[model samples]
Target: MEILSKEKNARNCKFKTRHGEIETPFFMPVATKASVKHLSSIELETIGTPAIISNSLVLYLRPGLEVIEKFKGLHNFMKFHNVIFTDSGGFQMLRPAFLIDYNEQGINFKSPFDGKKFNFTPEKSMEVQEKIGADVVMCLDNLPEYGQDYESVKDAVKLTHAWADRCIKAHKDKKQLLFGITQGSVFPALRKKSIEFFNKKEVDGLALGGLCIGESKKKMFDSIKLHAKYLRKDKVRYLMGVGSPPDIVNSVNEGIDIFDSVFPTQNARHGNLFTSKGKLHILRKEFFKDESPIDENCSCYVCKNYSRAYIQYQLKFKEGVGYKLATYHNIHYITNLMKEIRLNIKENNFKKFRKEFLSNWVTKE
Candidate 1:
């Protein structure tokens, strides 16, 4: 893999994987449980999706690694023949229902499936992802949730580095690339320390985790930019769990190469729709009689055919098709947005485009 293009801090890069070569500045839809809720692999493919992320820990709890190994890997199991990334279940540490304890022995959590307690070690995480056969796997780091005390966050960052060491030693899959994550919450010093630590690790890429978890937008981007120059420029930088249109554009300018989040799909199900003009509240009576596409600028299946009145009517009536249409359109819109960003980066005019995008993309509270 080589850096394809550079537009100041923003980059356009590509790396080869077992499935295919994934271009940088890409967004991945969260396909936890091997599915993207109401959407399917076919719909995802039609959207020109370059990659998707799944929770390896969830699959391990449900179907077990035996089922995944039977089909050769996650690609065969999910039937999605593109780049697949498997998270190390570090994000699950934030959920009280699933979390049991966080110590040097990796994460201890209750099985949401069967209520069984499990001790998941960094070595176990590496093995699970290898068995799952994702093209890229993330290191198992201790993720601190929002509002945790400063000392708690600092301890989490230390544990993250320790786990990263073990994860590096445990990962032996030559065909799969490993990415390390840095977690420091809102502390710039801790963020820098975490970033510098991973900068020397054997991982193929770096990821900034634990952001956008209730922190102010200014703080989130500040933490990102503070460590932006500290990151190894040769490797990819993934900003986990940030998927808003404005955030994605801003993070790209801050030098992020990859991102994955459930926010967009979750928003789509709740009647928050992404349009060229702005986010649309589909259930509003204003669209009850209006006969317009969700976004006239969008040429997705939903926008090219379905009218706002029809979608609003279906959603108001709780139709299943409504959720699917909304999810598809959101994914399609983001997929195209990523393409536009990469194009501008290659042309060395991303900042100009970013300025326009940040001003035009209206987000209603």
Candidate 2:
């Protein structure tokens, strides 16, 4: 709600949300099924996470409306009282081969658990979100796979915009915020058009979808820069599915306010740990005798209490605590990084911070 500071190199700005003030250039941990993988809500809060993302599609299918209705909504149901955002389930519905059937009217998708066919329209998405009760909800947009032709891309954009309109109309709670997602795969003109369309729609927030699916990093960054030019600076601008440390910092410098991805949790499960310097693979033979903490600078419980050698040994033996420790460290690393970025911005030295961080980070290999 307030602009704390602006970055000189990018359109990044720090703003406050109702639940808590989130520093711009921050990443939202992916909690697709109302929980981040292998971590509880209390653990997430302890790790200093600003927010988490839940999938509207997954919750709608597995728990159905009955479970959420009992609890009054996702926030109370999950017991995560902080800021929460819900993706319209558009992406997940189409990704798996057998999960969905695409049509102009709307998507007719099968529930992965029961194989019962379910239909999700833009209006229905809004209804589901309203019942689920998240602080931020996304419009149900058509997300096309990579390698689609121009006409298909164009049609998807048009449908996305149309659905955004329906979503806004169907939204009953004025207190809840709706964000429109821009969908145009690798086409700048289409991307530009989609941004212009949503800008006029006047949604509370904007997200650039359809990236990081299969596009090159070059294309992804270029598209973000171009879209940021047209997006409203006052409202939050979230770049969906981006959560790597480098990607987060770069996207933040490109004016992205929020992001979510499963990379940290997924990679942590495989023994990868994020640090201020860069990523470290803990399963390697070299760490067998190493006695240092995961990251020397990190003050996380995992870093303070354990060593890389102990984690490697635990992971080698397939211990559940190993996964928990790695996840805690990685999430803590990212959360702390964003905190530092905010401090740098308030001190008017974000450019210096970015340069020094990236220099040490990219040279780790």
Candidate 3:
């Protein structure tokens, strides 16, 4: 990876992973269960998605290792050629566990799919990701929800740092890159400590976890501003599980290089369309007679060939195609937004671009 340019706190960079090279600051569409809900890998590729994030937990539990090993790696299993990052399954800790416990041994939780119980140690996470085969593999980190006290946050950070060391020691795949996750909730002091600890580790990248998990936008951005500067500049900086338009713009300005979230695809499945001017509710009555595209400036196939009324009709009738089309358009919109962001950074006009975008992109309370 190389930083090509910088303007204020923002950076224009490029990363060459084992799978392929991608330009940063990029957005990764979430493929939680090895599929992006209503779309295929080919559809995602067609929409210009440079990469994607999938859950290692699902793959480990459902098909087991035998099925994936038959295909060698997730790329072969999913038939996706672009870059892929696998979550270490640490986020599962946030769920309501039928039986849960956390110790120095790691996370023990019941599988929601089956009644079987399993423990996911940092070593185990590394092993699963190695079998699942992603270009970038994440370390197992203790991620607590928002509003945790300082002591709890401090303990989470301690566990995260300990687990990161174990993951580093256990990861043996030379082709796969291991990334350490920083978890300190919104405590600036703890976050700074987490950053400093990982900066000295032998990990290939660093990811900001534990944000946007019910914290206010102000708190999240404040943490980003506080910790991003301390992150190793040469390593790829990923802000995990955040994909709102305004948040993406602000995070990029704070020097975050990669991001993944279910926002666009999930909202699109519910008849929401992300547009240049603002988010549009496709099911609204105002669009029933309107023949315009979702976004006049959108060049996605859905917008180019279909009218807003057509999509609304499909969505109103609950047609499967409606969800697919909407998902496609939303993914295209976000990826294109990333492209525009990179272009603006290259042109040294990122500040202007972000200000103008937010001014027009009205956010409803």
Candidate 4:
């Protein structure tokens, strides 16, 4: 990972993994359970996704390591040539209404896939991530609920920092890079302390977790401002689970270099589509006879070949093609936006680009 230059907080950088080299300020599409929902690997590649992130815990529980090991790693297993990052699944440990439990030792939870029970410790997270063998891996960090009390949030940060240390010790793969995670809910002081703690570690990168979990936009952006600067400038900085256009702009301005989220694809599945002008719901009555493409500015296959009326019809009728097309266009939209962001940063016009983009991009209603 290397930063080539900076325009204020926005960066033009290069990230080289075992699989390939990519520029920073890139977006990673989420492929939870080892596949991007409804989109094939070739389709993902065609849309120009530079990298992707997957769930380490889910893969370990579902397919098991033996399956991935047979193909040599996640890249070969999934047939993707680009970089892949696998999250440690510490976040998943916090879910499950009553079956989840965690202490300093580790987390104990029942697999949602098979009703089987399993324990996930810091060492175990590393073991699973290493076997999955993605270009980048994340440390297992405790994530408190979004609206937790200050004391709970403080304790979660302490546990996360402690787990980061253990993860560093257990991570032995030379080919894969391990990233330390910082958790502090929305408390600025705790966020600062968490960032500083990770700065002292020797991990390959740093990730900001526990945001966008139900917090207001103001709080989430404020938290980013409070801690993003404290991160080590020499390594990559990732904001986990954030992918809205406005949020991505804010994070990049705060110096975050990489991102991953299910928002675009997830929303696409439900007929919510993103466009250069604003968000669009294809199933709306306004598009009943609209023959226009999903986005006139977009050149993706879906936009190039289909119209709003057709996609709306497919979605309204519960046809599989609607989901696939929306997924394709949405991914293309965000990835294209990232490409434009990188260019603007290089040209020293990122501030202007962000301002113009957001001024015209309507996200709500």
Candidate 5:
């Protein structure tokens, strides 16, 4: 990791990977199925995306290891020749349908697609991800849900710690960076325990999991700050499952280096277009006749070439092209936002940038 510049707690760095170098304070769109829903690999490259995160277990179940191995790896299979990160599918534990039971051995999950049960041990997760060949691979973590009690969360923390060791031991790829995940739900003492455990291990990076699920924003940010303070600053800090203008800006200020979430693309599919001022509900009747771009401030291809009237018409009819355009704009906006964040940190004005941004960015409906 090369620390380029820092303003207060926020630092700009470069995380070198086997495929490429991912700049810190960057967001990765979730390509859980080896594809970002509405965009293609070519579009992702054009949007300035350096990295993407995919669900290892999902790919393992669907295309299977045979298909990916036949194509050489995920980069070749997906035609995305940039940096790629494969999530350990720990996030799947949040879904009641997928998670039947979890113990010290591993997790017992049922595939929602095939209705088949499978045992996913830490060693198995390491083996699968290594076969899938992502530049960055995460440890299989036990993520406690938002309202779970301390005892439950403590159990999760214990399991996560044990699994982290197993994952580390099983990981054999020297080129692929293995990141350990810290899960404590919303409990500070449990979070501290998890953090303290990973502090002793030599992982390429540390990910703050089990946040932004359903907890209050205050608690979420507090956890981020806690991770920022305790996790080794030399290695990269990744705050998983967080993506939004306000949350991202604040996370960056709190020293989060990398992020991945489906927020922008998911919200775009639902008609909420991110913009400089705020989110614009593009499907509203008011926009049906409006001739302006999605966001006047946004210089994305969608905004430059298309108008609100055109997009709304296509979206209203459920046209496939509409989804592509909306996803493109939202991703482009986020890409430019990260660029601005890196620039502000380099100029030592990130403090001012965060303040002004938070003051204007509101997510309430």
Candidate 6:
């Protein structure tokens, strides 16, 4: 709700939500099904996570609104007392029809849990988010997969813009922030058009969607840069579904203020760890006798008290400790990285840090 500081490269801001104030240039951990996989809300906060994202689609289908309303909202149900964002169910509708169905009216999908069919329209998505009571809610926009033909991409973009308008009209509360998603795939011009369309409407924030679905890293970065140039700097700009360390740094340099992805938690569940040097495969046999922590510089509890050998052995034997430790370390690495970026911005050295970090980080790739 307040602009703390504006850097040459980025805007450092503070957002006032019902839960609390969240600093800008923040990374929101993905809690797709109202949970961040292996981590709890308290644990997430302990690891320095300022915010979390939940999917409206998953919650709408599974427990349904009736169940969530019982708890009053997602905040009480999940017990996460921080800023929360709920994504429109548009992305999930892109799955196979057996899993989800899409139509002109909206998306119809069967509950993965009970085979019960459910419909999610733009208005319906807004209603669900209102019931969920997230601080920020995304509009239900049609998101197409990568490599679609130009005509299909054009149609999807048009539909998304229309849906955004409908969402804006349907939304009842001005206090709860709503964001318009820009969906143009890899086409820069379409992206620009989408940006202009939303810019006129003047939503609370703007999100760059439909990237990193299956595109190359170059294409993804290109799209981000192109869209970033067109977005309003005063309001927040969120780059969705992108959370790699390199990607995070690059997007920050491009002036992205918010981002959410499941990379760290998902990879940690699979025995992978991200570090300053690069990614590490902790499940490898080379760590069987290794004594060093996952990252010597990491100050997370896992890195402070455990060794790579210990984690590898635990994971090898399917112990829960390995997964929990790895998750903590990875989340810490990302949150710390963001902290360093924010500090650099305050010091006006973000460009220098970005260059130095990318040199070593990219070399490992």
lDDT of 6 at 74: 92
- Among residues 3 or more apart in sequence or in different chains, the pairs in candidate 2 whose N, CA or C atoms overlap within 3 Å are none
Residues 1-365 of candidate 1: C-alpha lDDT, one tens digit per residue: 57788888888999989887889899999998999889999899999999999999999987989899999988998899899999988788548979987779877889877899988999999999999999999999888769999899899999999999999999998789999999899988889999989989888999999998899999999998976888888899899989999899999988888989987899888888988767888888788898899899998989989998998888778799999999999999889999999999998899899989888888663
Number of colliding residue pairs in each model: 0, 0, 0, 0, 0, 2
Better of 4 and 5 by lDDT: 5
Q: Residue 353 of model 3: what lDDT?
A: 98
Q: Residue 169 in model 2: shift from native, Å?
A: 0.7
Show where candidate 6 strays beyond 4 Å. Answer: 1-3, 97-101, 362-365
Ten contiguous residues minimizing lDDT sum, candidate 1? 88-97
List the lowest-lDDT window of 10 residues for candidate 6. 356-365
Better of 5 and 6 by lDDT: 5
Task: Please give the distance, in angstroms, between residue 158's alpha carbon in candidate 5 and its true position after superposition.
Answer: 0.4
Candidate 1 vs candidate 5, lDDT winner: 5
Tens digits of lDDT, candidate 4, 95-180 = 87424688998999888766788888899999999989889999999987789999999999999988889999998987788888
> What's the lDDT for all of these models?
0.89, 0.84, 0.89, 0.88, 0.90, 0.84
Residue-wise lDDT of candidate 6 within 152-172, one digit each (tens)? 999999989888888999998
Query: Best candidate, lDDT-wise?
Result: 5
- Model 5, which residues run further than 4 Å from truth? 362-365
Q: In candidate 1, list every pair of residues with a backbone clash.
A: none
